[model samples]
Target: METRPRGRDGTGVTNTDAGPGLVEPVPGYRTRVVDEGARDGPAVVLLHGTPLDLRAWDPLVPALRATRRVVRFDARGHGVAEDVPVPDVGRLAADVVAVLDHLGVADAHVVGHSWGGEIAQRVAVEHPGRVARLSLVCTRASPFPPFGELAASLRGGTVDLEALLGRWFTPAERAEPAGAAATVRAWLRDADRERWAEALDMIATFDGLADLAAVAAPADVVVAELDAVATPAHMAEIARTLPDAACHVLPGARHLAPLQHADAIARVLLA
Candidate 1:
């Protein structure tokens, strides 16, 4: 079997490819899809959460490429995905299966963070054979206002983008002009206001919580110790709901654990 690929310094492999090997998973629904890592290794699909794109996974992919086929994409209406979006969460779930089918991957380890996890869970139920393992990071199976009371601020009035960003980063991180927090801040600023609000509305009323019991694949439920957005208590319920699941905590991490604790998450993904 292939062992995990290592960088020259014994860390992780360097991804040198400039990629977005496009695949039209659904007709008229083109999104940016990037394929990386070992060609023959088992596939691993990484899905990003709201207001972010596939680039959110960049920090985490290096750690897996040595021994796994890593695939990531911008979800509908985010990143390079067209302004038009799938109608609802169920359609979002269908896109995941479509991506795998485009790759000719029979099954894969589907890993999602936040809203992405909702999509992962749906696929595990609706397309069980296509998901070998499920990993949910900083996410929940049930419906919860991801933005808390701030969600109302997104509706009808001017969005306090800064306030929305504060929920994901420290006061200090928000002040900085660069770094993970700033990167996300930019994504939100550039996001189409209508689509961003729509994305929020979609998650508000839809979730995979009701169907967790039917998911047959083993699951890895991970939460950020310091994440107020997706609190551990809320995320913990995902593991409890799934028939087979193990929960893990990324210590000292906030909601962006994929960026803050990429190496550790990489270990969990490969484990």
Candidate 2:
């Protein structure tokens, strides 16, 4: 991977690639897919959350590429994915399988963060054979309360973007490395407003707990100790519900634990 400061401008092209490699498995939405690592290595797919693109995985991608073929993509309504009608969890899950099929990948290790984590759960449950292992980071199995509130607040026109991010991440975390907060802030700002809102609306009403029993992959549920959206208790419940799931709580992290604690998350994904 090229070293270009690790931030994408919503074009679906990262530092390593010169052009967007888009695939349209289904009409209307063109998904941006990227592949890295060895030509003949175990495949691993990384999924990003709402309001951000695949660049959210920049911190963990290099480490994962060391031993696995790391794939990252921009989900519909985010990054380079065309602005189409918001898709339900089922369609989102289908998109993942389509991306894998487009790459001719029979199976892969799946990793997701926040909203992406919920989609990852759907992929493991809905397409059990396609996922070798699952890693859910800072996600919940049931509907997320914070998203509902955020949608309502945004609709009411009473929230500021920066303030909203502050609520998602702690003040201390935003202060870390001086410019850590800028990357995420810019990502959210560049997203298509209509699509971003619709995606959040869909996520606010989603629930994946009903399908937990069908997930056959060995799973790791990682949560941040300071996460307010997907609380530690909620993640614990998710872990307990999964027949083959283990939970890891990283200290001093927030909702963006996958990026904030990338090393810890990489360890979990690599394990």
Compared with the true structure, model 2 gives a TM-score of 0.89
Q: What is the C-alpha RMSD of each candidate to the true structure, in Å?
A: 6.4, 3.3
Local distance difference test, each candidate: 0.78, 0.80
Return the lDDT, model 2, position 257.
Answer: 77
Worst 10 residues of 2 by lDDT: 1-10
TM-score of each: 0.88, 0.89
Residue 137 in candidate 2 has what lDDT?
A: 92
Best by lDDT: 2
lDDT of 1 by residue, 1-271 (tens): 0122233444333233443355579998876677778979999999888877777887888889999998888788776674866367778888998988887889999999887888888888888999999999997666566543344665556678887677778899898877887777777767666666776666676666769888889999988998886788877877888899988998888888897789989888888
